[model samples]
Target: MSRHNIPDALWQRLEPLVCLPRKDPRGRPAKDARLMFNGVLWILRTGAPWRDLPAEFGPW
Candidate 1:
């Protein structure tokens, strides 16, 4: 309300989307999606093998 750079209509349009659920309901997230993706991406980026991942986070 105090004159920010972002437009009011954009805020209104994007507001509801902020509350959407991000992960599956059944199991614990184990890790947040973005972080998990980044870790997997790091592994792929570095060409690391699957056996290197931590116990709970691997082969699920």
Candidate 2:
């Protein structure tokens, strides 16, 4: 896990709260919720603009 990523303990709690999309006859699939959540956390944790997010988060 990356240092900036969510910890498993916290993720266990958070994972239950997110609703993911199914791939059945849908539009573009949603990105991985874990990564997206981590990306959001990264920005909030760093207090940085979304454009300034690290590349490790992928195309912020």
- Local distance difference test scores for all models: 0.50, 0.82
Model 1, position 12, has a per-residue lDDT of 62
Best by lDDT: 2
In model 2, the runs with Cα more than 4 Å from the true position are: 20-27
Q: What are the RMSDs of all candidates, in order?
A: 11.2, 2.6
List runs of model 1 lying over 4 Å from the truth: 1-24, 51-60
Estimate, for each residue in 1-60, the C-alpha lDDT of model 1 and write its tens digit: 322123557656654664457576896644444334444655676677867754444452
Model 2 Cα lDDT, one tens digit per residue, 11-49 = 888887874446486686646788888999888898999
Give each model a TM-score: 0.36, 0.71
Query: Which pairs of residues collide in model 1?
Result: none
User: For every model in order, what is the number of clashing pairs?
Assistant: 0, 0
